[model samples]
Target: MSAAPKHDVFQAVADPTRRQLLSLLAESDELTVSALSAPFAMSRTAVSKHLRVLSEAGLVRERKAGRETRYRLEAEPLQELRRWLDYYERFWTNRLSVLRQLVESDDADEDVLEPRGPRAVD
Candidate 1:
């Protein structure tokens, strides 16, 4: 099976603002839109738009909190990315194991070789 997905989680997270929002949400359980946008030098509307895309991707949830709406991180969708990556992780592990074996074999060969003067190369 192909390892990584052709899906667009990377695209969704491409924006610096969106990444910041995700980081903030990860640090806190839930926050109001105002709270989420507090660190950014942007308008409420702009932040809301980013939040909307995140919501559509199942990465965030918005719910009415008294008069203000709060955004909560829905991290379960990250599992899709992880599952897609699992195959590649296994492949890399196998490749690294082979590299380690090769390196160890090289060391063993070096130990068995008698000391010799450097060879001249053209």
Candidate 2:
């Protein structure tokens, strides 16, 4: 049997904290858990947990630096997320295009002129 998936990118970014962690890592080439958690009220361990999710999703890579572990954004996994979004982006774009056409059609103007029912004399 195929090995169970360790993590999925969609699941990893579902958490707000993890999203913020990814944003933080994006701002810098690499950061330690302490530095990454400094902007938040959570402890380093809490931040580490979030980082672990991102790491498993392949969104970030970590390396041991002296006594500290440094984490950097992997980014490639995010491209998968982007690809998924692009599919919906096209879906919405097509939907909106159809709606726009319907609204702009001459038939819409005729509908506006027709009264739904008897209107009180103005």
Candidate 3:
């Protein structure tokens, strides 16, 4: 049988907790559950659940050592997210550039003219 559709990595990363975990993992190679939990006020179980979602999305990996499971960031899935967002980068850049121009331009007449109203319907 064909392989099942992969889970949506971007959607999985939409959570703030997951994003924070990813950031921490990226900075440090591997961190224990307690170490990861120290920065937030959440319970260890809640952090574990966040890690589980990230693991399923292929954004992180957990390795068992003795009684502890260490979590590490896997950057490959993030590259996929970056590639997806690259498509829209130019559109946002263009919009921001226009906004910057409007805000920084020194031409007084340009700002004084109110935008024209739509033509009356027939």
Candidate 4:
């Protein structure tokens, strides 16, 4: 039988609902599926599905509590996403700095070239 498709951190967080779930879980030590489902208009099953995606991505861990399953945020997987974003943040910051310098240099040159007073026409 073919294995279930694996999910990555990006794919896991692509859904707004899943992102919300992550945010909620991050604020607490752990919570039951029902507690996680409380804030959303969707049913418990839908919330469970989102949790499943997160679990597959390694962003969440689940523990069996009798008939209830408790889930907690596993933030290590998110480090990968953070690192990727940080690299681009640095890239854009450097580019913006260079652009700012160029603009300021151009302004300085314009100041030097402009006459300080009215032109003395012959």
**How many clashes show up per model?**
0, 0, 0, 0
Estimated TM-score for each candidate: 0.70, 0.84, 0.74, 0.82
Which is better, 1 or 3, measured by TM-score?
3
lDDT of each: 0.82, 0.89, 0.86, 0.92
Residue 29, model 1: Cα distance from true site in angstroms: 2.7
| Candidate 3 per-residue C-alpha lDDT over 12-63 given as tens digits, one digit per residue, 9 for 90 to 100 | 7999989999999989989999999999999999999888888888888899
Q: Regarding lDDT, does 2 or 4 come out ahead?
A: 4
Q: Which pairs of residues collide in candidate 3?
A: none
Top-lDDT structure, candidate number: 4
Residue 116 lDDT in candidate 4: 100
The C-alpha local distance difference test score for the whole of candidate 4 amounts to 0.92
Q: Over 4 Å off in model 2, which ranges?
A: 1-5, 109-122
- Model 3, TM vs. native: 0.74
**Candidate number that wins on TM-score, 1 or 4:** 4
Whole-structure CA lDDT of model 3 = 0.86
Residue 70 Cα positional deviation in candidate 2, in Å, after optimal superposition: 0.3
C-alpha positional error of residue 30 in candidate 1 after TM-score superposition, expressed in Å = 1.6
Between candidates 1 and 4, the lDDT winner: 4
